[model samples]
Target: MEYNEFITHVQTLTQSDSREEAERATLAILKTINELVPDEEMQEIAVQLPQKLGEILREKETKSNQSFNLQEFIERASQKENIKPTTTAIHARAVFSVLQSSITPDVFTKFHKYFSHDYEELFFTSP
Candidate 1:
């Protein structure tokens, strides 16, 4: 997807008030993923995304050991995006949904493998 289409999907999925909100959420999640996924894996995921969106993942380098769990992951994005922790999960799922749909399945499988099983919850909304 193009950057606008990706932002639109995120806004629609998260029910954001504007494009900026969706963009912020997208960056927050992408940066958070940058901290979690290894460099090689992240590079693979980045190449499949829109240039602008991929740049966020490429530009932000994290020295974190990536020892955090799912809850911590949400909290980090919430803090970075300057949104409520409760809402961060919603934004994260929206971003993940967009990522899954936009990228190749093989690359997505590789991306998904980096996160633990509990993190799978971020990929889908609660039923």
Candidate 2:
């Protein structure tokens, strides 16, 4: 999706009040995800992302790399954005939903392999 479409979808999904809020949440979610997936895969995904979003992911390329499961992923994104884990989970699921639609299903599955099956709900909002 284009950047505008991306932001609009995020705002709709998150019920964000303003453009800034949506941008912050989207960038935070992307950056947090950048820290999780491997460098090579991140590069591949970045190519499919918008210019600014791609740059955000690339900026994390040389930063510290972290490996986290589903809960820790939500916790870290929450801490990074200074939000609650429950709230972060919602934002993250929105991001993942966008990614699932934007990226090839094969590559999206590859990214999820980084997490465990417990994250399935975060993927498709399963019960």
Candidate 3:
């Protein structure tokens, strides 16, 4: 996915009217997610994304405060985006759904391993 495609798909997927909104949601999602997974795993995932987005994730991957779990991840994401937990899930699912199509299956598989099965519903947009 290229930069425009990645951002557009996320905006369309999340039904966001503003470009900044989509960007914020994506940044929060990626930043929060990178905090949960190992940097190596995120690097694998990032290489498959658009350069801009890959850089975004990579920048976040090196944070010292990366010990948060799924629930804390959501909380931080929600706070970043100024939304509720449920709304954060919507944003995260938008990005994850894009990631599903963009990254290798194995990378996404590794992503899920960092969390419980409860995250499946949040990380994948069901058909």
For TM-score, the strongest prediction is: 1
Q: Per-residue lDDT for 1-127 in model 1, tens only?
A: 8999999999999998889899999999999989988778877888989999888877756663376889989999999999899889999999999999989989988888878888987775337
Look at candidate 3 and tell me the lDDT of residue 84.
91
lDDT per model vs. reference: 0.87, 0.79, 0.81
TM-scores, all candidates, are 0.92, 0.87, 0.86
Candidate 3, clashing residue pairs? none
Question: How many clashes (backbone N, Cα, C below 3 Å) per candidate?
Answer: 0, 0, 0
Which clashing pairs does model 2 show? Answer: none
Candidate 3 residue lDDT tens string, 1-127: 7888888999999998988889999988887777777778878988889888888778853453356566777898998899899888888889888888898888877777777666767776457
Error of 2 at 20 (Å): 1.6
Best-first order by TM-score: 1, 2, 3
Q: Which runs in model 2 stand beyond 4 Å of their true positions?
A: 61-65, 125-127
lDDT digits (tens) for residues 26-127 of candidate 2: 887887888777788888788888887878877764353476678887887887778788888888878888877787878877887877777787786436
Better lDDT candidate (1, 3): 1
User: Where is model 1 more than 4 Å wrong at Cα?
Assistant: 125-127
Q: How well does candidate 3 score on lDDT at residue 119?
A: 71
